[model samples]
Target: MSLATSIRRNLFVLVGLGGIALSAQGAAAQPLDSALAAAYVNNPTLNAQRAGTRATDENVSKALSGYRPTLNGGISAGFQATRIRTPGALTAYENLWPATFALTAAQTLFDGFITANSTEAAESQVRGSRETLRNTEQQVLLDGVTAYMNVIQAIALLDLQRQNLAALEQELRATRDRFNVGEVTRTDVAQAEARVADAQYGVSQAIANLSASRAVYRQVIGVEPGKLTFPASIERMLPSNVDRVISLGLSQHPAIKASQFAVDAALFQVKVAEGTLMPNLSLQGQLSQGYDSSISVESTGAAAVTLNLSVPIYQGGVEYANIRQSKELLSQARIEVDVNRDAIRAQAVQFWGAFEAAKSQIQAAQAAVAANTLALQGVREEWRVGQRTTTDVLNAQRDLTNSRSALVVAQRDRVVAAYSLVSTVGKLDAQSLRLKVRAYNPVTHYEQVRDSWAGLRTPDGQ
Candidate 1:
């Protein structure tokens, strides 16, 4: 049988064990999409990033506060006592109670456009945060795919190891029978025994590897792996060529977009800093009532309104320093955009190469497995007819087993490389994959809280 067919047959044999593993969760096929969806909603890292983005949305509300008015009220109550004594007069004492109530309001009429520039900067930051969240989502999904494929590959390898051990044990038994009948020498039996022992060691290693892979799968998928269905090929969803992939990555990658937004925010921040060197104007009003229980024994009220303007006259040169610092930050932000673009471009090239290389590797591995399978059969037949030695047969078996293992690894790499390429081009997301889960919309939270005037709690009441 072809190596691919043999692998599939062995995979079917593993279904019963996989089913038992999932018995607690109720046996069902855990497809790749399900794992991705679970991670999207449940992975702590991804969820924490989402929460961070939501917090970033609050920057807009804080910036908008510059355009609003501030009001405050206060009340005070106290007792005043006085004692007087003169040389010719009797002592006199007086106690009086005093109370006051006040209300004050202040509004910023103008601030050299600092408020406007700050608000615009905050909005740009919000957009940048959304892009950052998108990049995080893509990373989480890619990790999910990688973890899922790792478990599958480990399981397949373990199965191949066990099969190799069984075959070696059968060959050892046959060699022993020949030794007993004087058809083979004691050295032949010893050689077969040593090969069997090595095969046993391989089985142990495979088991350990499988266990480690399952642990990683649990950590990433938020659950123990079950009867994982093999994922279908995604090549059809990929771009036509490396050039197309790189082009898309340069234009569509979230990291680049996020950095671009950062540049915009920094540019506005520079404007805000420059505004600090200009005049600030505001208006203030206050009303108060005071009452006293003294000789006057009456209440008095007062009201006042003031228009305030403050011109900066070199207050320690901090404003100028801030403007210079903001300009430097703007330059850094612009550089970061180019950095991200170059990074995405390089990733696009690397993954595309891996994707194509893995495809060719699969074909080459399949051909090697086919050739090694026939060679082993022929070597065994020749050994039976006294034309080949026991060492030759053992060598043939080893070669066949190695080829099969290579085939398994190549198959896994092909699938993973395809997914990785998709991610490099900025398309590996829940929306693009049409995963069966509700999408988390960062814009919803931003829209809900952008114009909020006052709130001690978040939009979700947390």
Candidate 2:
């Protein structure tokens, strides 16, 4: 709504509201789902987290390596000479050439369950990394949603500002006409001119803010925002009450999941460290050949299999120190789980409050806009009949503009806050929202790579 009826009708065209938008060379019909999909599929930060999780998955294979056999081969060649001197020696000197090639293999029969525990620890880390990735996805998607809404909010504010400018220009023209006819004084016309300038300044500020919001939208969503239509409200998707929200958040938050997994991994790490104090058993085999030891015409070969045993009696207390350190880390990890739970609860409560605030603000702003629209209309008419001053009309217009802008901002905050609450509950991902894009599965890489003896290429050959 605008103070001037003529400008109100032209408002849509004057500021591109609810119509074709002035943006990049594409159809201006971007939807929230598409924006989120783009961020999920192509956002570098989220994709990097995916890569980091995949990398973590490889640790499982590395830890599993302890259970596998190790093979090594080597070759060597050398010359040997000996000289003997006595009163009457059988032979004064003797020379021989020696060469050997050896291949050794060792397979661990037992290592105090080190491989099993380490593999479990690595697997826990993989789980933690996956949960971390999910958290990142939620954050990235929420950021995209917020950025989109910010752009749309900025556009609406700028449009309202332009509407204010147009309304003020209309008032200024009328005041100028009345003053020319000696009906209104020059001071009224001057006041109208000053208000028009202020409205123009407001429009400029809105334009600058819109530009900044667009930049952020482009950065978050990976493309310049097109003309955006308001997506359907997700308030229905949120928990009905704060208690339910906190319950869901505690049960499902990715930070909590990740922290829990970290604690498990740390416990396993403690086991791994303690494993070093135990004895290890392994089976080893070696084969060697010696050639050209007798006038270049003799050769000899040998083969042996040995059971190797190693018991760590004491070695500067490093193993005990490592065990102590790992236990301390496990303790820290357990404490961090509780810390993450509290942090997520705080986030849930904070976002829920924000959502409520937005609701109240929206209602209040809407009422203010309605009342100020009426006041502006009345003030303009009273000015027409010398019952009110130009200053009154200007103040009414400003009040209406501020109220409308506040309503727009509150509407934007409502959407952002709703999505943020969903994220805090770890349900803001594509799977939760049933997005169109196929979800990235971190387990696929883990299953493909884990237990693999050797490989240079990835599962998909990349």
**Candidates' lDDT values, in order?**
0.85, 0.86
Q: What shift in Å separates residue 342 of candidate 1 from its native position after superposition?
A: 1.5
Candidate 1, superposed: residue stretches over 4 Å from native? 1-26, 85-88, 293-297
Each prediction's TM-score versus the true structure = 0.92, 0.91
Give per-model CA RMSD: 3.4, 3.2
State which candidate has the highest TM-score.
Answer: 1
Compose the digit string of candidate 1's lDDT tens values, residues 286-365.
99999884645678899999999999998898889999999999999999998998888888888888878877876787
